[model samples]
Target: MPVMPSSAPSVEKGPTLRNDSFSDRRDSVNKLETGCLSIIVLGASGDLAKKKTFPALFNLYRQGFLQSSGVHIFGYARTKISDDELRARIRGYLVHGKGGPPHTHSEDVSKFLQLIKYVSGSYDAEDRFRLLDKEISKHEISKNIQEGSSQRLFYLALPPLVYPTVCKMIRRFCMNKYNHGGWTRIVVEKPFGKDLESAEKLSTQLGDLFDESQLYRIDHYLGKELVQNLLVLRFANRFFLPLWNRDNIDNIQIVFREDFGTEGRGGYFDEYGIIRDIFQNHLLQVLCLVAMEKPVSLRPEHIRDEKVKVLQSVLPIKSEEVVLGQYEGYRDDPTVPDSSNTPTFATVVLRIDNERWEGVPFILKAGKALNSRKAEIRVQFKDVPGDIFRCKRQGRNEFVIRLQPSEAMYMKLTVKQPGLEMSTILSELDLSYGQRYQGVTIPEAYERLILDTIRGDQQHFVRRDELKAAWEIFTPLLHRIDDGELKPLPYKPGSRGPVEADVLLSKAGYRQTHGYVWISPSL
Candidate 1:
């Protein structure tokens, strides 16, 4: 088991601090930036900032993850909006589905909104960024923070094309190394780059300005409760440790399916398709956790090092083992080109050339406009050598980890029928989260990841080399698709993607259970 860091820093003025509040206080050696802190959203007026970024910050603020007195939120963009206008715009989103209901939390929402200040600026204009710095400095001064002790965090919620300029502006104008004794951290979102070459170039650019420790590459999926539970379910479990390898497991599937297509983001989706959008990053990150060796310690670096090894061991992808499909109505979106061949669905079989995973296929399937909306990991164990009970016909023993909608970990195993007859049937050992963890509102993925960034933990974030290894694995296939050599097969919207996808899965040794479906247990 991993142990916590011996000590942690505290805020000068605010609710008292504790190590676990920032992190497990383990693995990472970063000092908690607990004093006067400024969280600047670089693309503040944008949709991402309004929808995810601000809402997450508000949750952290009310939960005391953020220092109410010393911490401030800043919005920066070229929209030329006032602080009050930004506040009003942000207010509309803080009241949302699970943790949000306007009337119940109106007072807290208002208070949280008040902590945010907005600054308008161009991505490349040093003078405009200089104004942003001034506002940040002014807020720190007002909070009684000394000149050399101010924590500045800038979140780039903008498109990647503008990352270089925005990063340049932050490094030149707002970095704590230049203006304060406290630290400066930047959180950037993904589609880190389209391919390996571009990803490395971007990394080099960011590396020149900041140490790797100061940059947090946020992947919200990693923060999901189930995904975060992967390590515990594996390393900490006595039974799974032996059966997780190629010997007992037949095949593993990590799936992501959505009930709706791109909506109106087709213009952007057309350029990257499903592989870049879902597989390369989200599915692959999940694969790392599912396939990696247990790290020596839970330190962020140790865990990340194991993930890197898994990625590095993956063999080159073969075309015959891949299935790509474009939903019939995908191009109907006005933003999508009439002749666009962008795939809304894809299933890629990745094989890791390592002792534990050799001969086992790690199938990652993702699609938009499917029959359902859910994400899950299914691990099917091989059939027993002697089927005396005749349970093989019932189905193979499979352990499933559902990642969303209703979180769960259930095992489908053979059991005697509940009757006075001598018969066997497949039943589940269910741990449906809704029923098992009633009244527990799982924190939003963005909320948890943002907090980790504040805590300086990278165990859940992608490491630089890890990102490089991932891009290298998919770059060849991506280039082939771009060159129109590997065309996407067409499939109807709302259907299981092209039948060929299923055929590929079967050829790769995946057997679907017949006559039985596992329903999530209700609360």
Candidate 2:
């Protein structure tokens, strides 16, 4: 067990404030820099553990951000499988799933295989947990680190039901013994809980054993580089900051549209409908990153504070302003039963009552089985009221930040025609990732998130208050859906969505921010 260095800052007083006149703060001491650590992933045999989790870790390692020599990995799960079976199961997902890495390089694959070791046990049984703890301790001691000097991380890749059991077992047997000598950090996956109360209870239960800092709430959306660039795009650049308010901007739309229905996994999909499934965890987080007030500092808590404020500011959505859609299943897809309770699509007309966005609506329209797969943010600047260029065929100025297939920033404004004509036409000032940074492989979301956890940066992780705030914003709609008051509009398999979705936007005098139409000139 590696204890916090005596030189480590005192936690009772909180992080020290940094200043020019004062010496460096204590929090800055063990604060992880860009590249210096090894990560141990628990539950490395599960679906997420293999398809997303391992590939992400491997990408970071391949990119040279993770140290190849000192790093270690261990996979813990219930299924009693041999090492070859575990590797084969992981390989199936890696070579075949979306965003999975290639299965090349026998030498490199062997090296990574050497890092992985699996242990099997029933998660609910205490004796199994005791055995697992003993295994971890023996491995750490055998590494030849004096009497202590071991740091461990446990990632909960399991679902919400098993989380409490896992947490309690770790606390009672695994973490308590290592608390004083070494640090143990636990990273939890989201849909933190099904509702606000559940989220709070889980946090409280976890916090009983681990301090707030030790518990990292993962939201993989924040791992994308484009998502992180949002801060830089808004705050760092003075060009667009002035026009970001209600005065110049008409409305902001954050969309996460998908074209495919729930392919199998009906059990998980039906339990968590559209509201709890995507909007609460992913879409809301994106909205917060865009709408949050500038943090006082780059500290994790400080950044989370601003995000919470945005979530809190989001007004309770009325039943009329939102629309839910369910893509009915076909006879071919046997997984989706006729009586399935899951929603395949959803749209929320959210509002923030803060001064900067008092009247402007922030619409979040996301769904599966839509016309196309798109994820982007559109900021429609207020139309020029009495534009001098109106006679010259002008259009609204819009800024778009795209985060899929290609990561890029683009602005649509009317530019003068090049053929010696004075007529104004809309053209795009595009900064596509493909065009600008050639040959640079932008990492997948999971890869970046896994690396960040190893580095101990909580900026991308969700906070407890933020989680509650997100659930609060969606609770009313959830209630409406539960009480049979809210009905989903039926949309076709290949269409954009139901007609009600169009009405939801049209009533507000805005249109759905479709990419192709937003790009093409009006005939």
- Which candidate's lDDT is highest? 1
- Relative to the true structure, candidate 1 has a C-alpha RMSD (angstroms) of 3.8
Clashes per candidate (backbone, < 3 Å):
2, 6
Residue-level lDDT tens digits of model 2 in 10-51: 331111112222153333322222211224455767778887
lDDT of 2 at 493: 87
Q: Give lDDT: candidate 2, residue 287.
A: 92
RMSD value for candidate 2? 5.8
Residue pairs of candidate 2 with colliding backbone atoms: 1-149, 2-150, 2-181, 2-182, 3-181, 56-447
In candidate 1, stretches whose alpha carbon ends up further than 4 angstroms from where it belongs are 1-16, 19-34, 146-148, 177-181
For each candidate, give its TM-score against the true structure: 0.94, 0.88
